[model samples]
Target: METTQPSGTTKRRVELRITRPTLTWFARPTVTIDGVGHPAQWGTGTWAVPDEGGTRIGVYLYNRVWRFGTATRTVTAADVSLVYRSGPLPVGAGRLDAA
Candidate 1:
């Protein structure tokens, strides 16, 4: 007799890439998916999302020197690549846009 594997055993992978502007300073960026945080170092990476949907992606930039200053953005399922640019103040010093 022949046996077949279950379809649910397969996993889907999503590729994520991030770029940072040259003028950013004293800020550390991180990417969050489904409330899980991942390093946002300038490069390429991969992540796994739920098969049934309902995934939230966010980019946060933390300013070490400033205690109350941080930048964050959360969105639904969308493009995987993002670009980080410099903003005006420390609270909004970093910005993430679809790349």
Candidate 2:
């Protein structure tokens, strides 16, 4: 969906679907867009897109001791759907792709 921001600039949104295996130990996922952090839960979530194209997105699971299962991607489509799938091992990079 798209909405107008207070600055009169039009902003868009992208749907983010996140999932992980059973061994995350209750650590939450953080979705970072354009260097800003946003707390995310499992399943579907939405993030506001400040720019329509060339938006940077990153996802990682923080277990307090280490930050792993990290993924990053750049989006250029007007309507986009992203998914983050954690790796089997917690110390590896996660899969992030368009869905």
Candidate 3:
């Protein structure tokens, strides 16, 4: 899916980083921009405008233990880096936390 912004809207790049707790299992990270999922094998860098409400960004971490589960969060800034943690449970638990 493609997202279009209004004219004169300023766009900036934001970096999203996903990390796993020590001793945790493997996790596949995916970034959701305005509700659209984008598979991020390494990390995600995307353009967004803070004023535009369509700039809701999230990071989801999927693992074998938490099947069908993902940790999601919203980002609303530019030139900023957001971090999320993934694990079996008690860590993340399908919720994103700022690091």
Candidate 4:
């Protein structure tokens, strides 16, 4: 469900598909929308964001040692579906693509 902002505007949401080659993760993933961090799980999730253009979406996995599998994308008003694929290795950045 969409949330109502203090200004009474319904917050926009986007569908995020998160996946990694590994079976498990020590810590949950984080979805950062416009710099705000939201905890997320694997598979599919819906995240609330501002209802405006030029929104930046970022996803990353945080292990106990360090944060990796990072990716970022700038979405427009009509953009919604997104998929974040973690890199095979834990050191480099991942891929974020429109789905």
The candidate scoring highest on TM-score is 2
lDDT of 1 by residue, 24-88 (tens): 56766677876778766766776665554456666666666653223345433565555555555
CA lDDT of every candidate: 0.57, 0.84, 0.59, 0.82
Q: With candidate 1 superimposed using the best TM-score fit, by how many Å does residue 51's alpha carbon deviate from the native?
A: 1.4
> In lDDT terms, how accurate is model 2?
0.84
TM-score of each: 0.57, 0.85, 0.56, 0.84
Query: Which sections of candidate 3 miss by over 4 Å?
Result: 1-10, 23-26, 43-54, 63-69, 88-99
Once fitted onto the true fold, the runs of candidate 2 whose alpha carbons sit more than 4 angstroms away are 1-10
In model 1, state the lDDT of residue 46: 68
Q: Cα deviation in Å at residue 37, candidate 2? A: 1.1
* Distance from true location, Cα of 87 in model 4, Å: 0.7
Q: Please write out the lDDT profile of model 3 over residues 1-99, one tens digit for every residue.
A: 468767767656666666654544576667777787777765444445455443666666667766333665555543366666655553545555544
Give me the overall lDDT of model 3. 0.59
lDDT of 4 by residue, 1-99 (tens): 556457546488889999864633574689998788888888998876778888899998897878988899998888889999987667778888999
Clashing pairs in 2: none
